[model samples]
Target: MEGGKRGDEAGPSSEKLGELSEKLNEVCHVGEDEEDEDEDHRSNGVAAGFVPGPLVSLKEQIEKDKDDDSLRRWKQKLLGCLESDSDGQMEPEVKFHSISIVSDDFGEINTPLPVDENQIGRVLFTLKEGSEYRLKLTFSVLHNIVSGLTYSNTVWKGGLQVDQSKGMLGTFAPNREPYEHTLEEETTPSGVLARGLYSARLKFEDDDKRCYMELKYSFEIKRQS
Candidate 1:
């Protein structure tokens, strides 16, 4: 009788263990699904045909065709007021000042760069659902020319990537004044299902695939109150 009782007790314990194992498997599958989604997103980006070129200094380029007056004049026009002697610096450097969201209803909301660590994961701003908006980035370039400066943004909701976008901001030469580039307009997703907090990563890179800055932040989409 004691042996039978022990077996009965073991039965409940075995059932409990089975339940726990199933729960663990579900959690692991969820994690794997998220990883697969991220991998697919990366694959799509790689297929976009962005190939980084070899890095060459502006001074070396200018010296290559010293005898070609027409080429020299064209280079001068392309580089603006940049003096040829100013190529003393080695690699290009970019410092972001601020990012602003412009909208017809909300006007403009600006956020200064180098966000505090404490605020990194916090919601920086809220947007009205279905509202059209544009992002304006203000930054300064120093040292050498930044070739093929590009901006990319990826957004996620509930551990699932919802959107991704990339655009070229063009090459820039060192300048005393900051340059402002406004992105193409975008409309926020509408409806009750779209109203929620979303996380996003913004990245800035050059032709050499050198990342200048990366920022992770959150925002909320709400119905206009």
Candidate 2:
């Protein structure tokens, strides 16, 4: 009788173990499915637009069809006003000089690159709610050509994402002069509820998905006095 009772107890224990094992498998499969979905989403997002071309050395490109006068002129025109003494560069380099917020009400507020350490975590600037503004970026390309350079900005309020933007800066060749790009105009959301501090991340990347820079900053929207 004791042996039979022990077997009966063992039967329920084994059943519980089996139930736990099935639950664990289900959880693992769910996690894997979510990961796969995320991968597919990322792949589809990139494939939908702006596929980067293969990296080619600037020297090789300059050497191609050297004898063709028309092609040479065309290349020169395409690559605007390159430095006469510029050496053949193997890879591209980008240097961000500054960013400016331009608005009719506020004029312009310029922030220099590599923000000061003391200013880190501090509010960079404040904007009046409902005001329209445009962002201007000044940068320079050095060495080789930069292809499909793009900009992205994401803003969050109270740990929740509120806005996102992406803009294509286009391909650029090394030049002595800096390039200035003004983004499309945007109006700040207006409301008592919208007046608050917000955190943002700005990123610059190329067609290869190589990140040139990423900056995190905070700003505030205030009610107009």
Best-fitting candidate, measured by TM-score?
Answer: 2
Alpha-carbon RMSD of each model: 24.7, 22.6
Provide TM-scores for the models.
0.71, 0.73
**Residue lDDT tens for model 2, 115-169:** 8888765687789999898989999988777777777778889998888877777
lDDT of 2: 0.68
Candidate 1 accuracy as TM-score = 0.71
**How accurate locally, in lDDT, is each candidate?**
0.69, 0.68
Task: Please write out the lDDT profile of model 1 over residues 1-225, one tens digit for every residue.
Answer: 122223322332343324221211111111112223342354424424666444456565545444445444545555554664566566678999998989887799899998889888778778999888898999998766776777777899999889887777877767778999999898899999799999998887665556788889998899977
- Which portions of model 1 show Cα errors greater than 4 Å? 1-54, 84-87
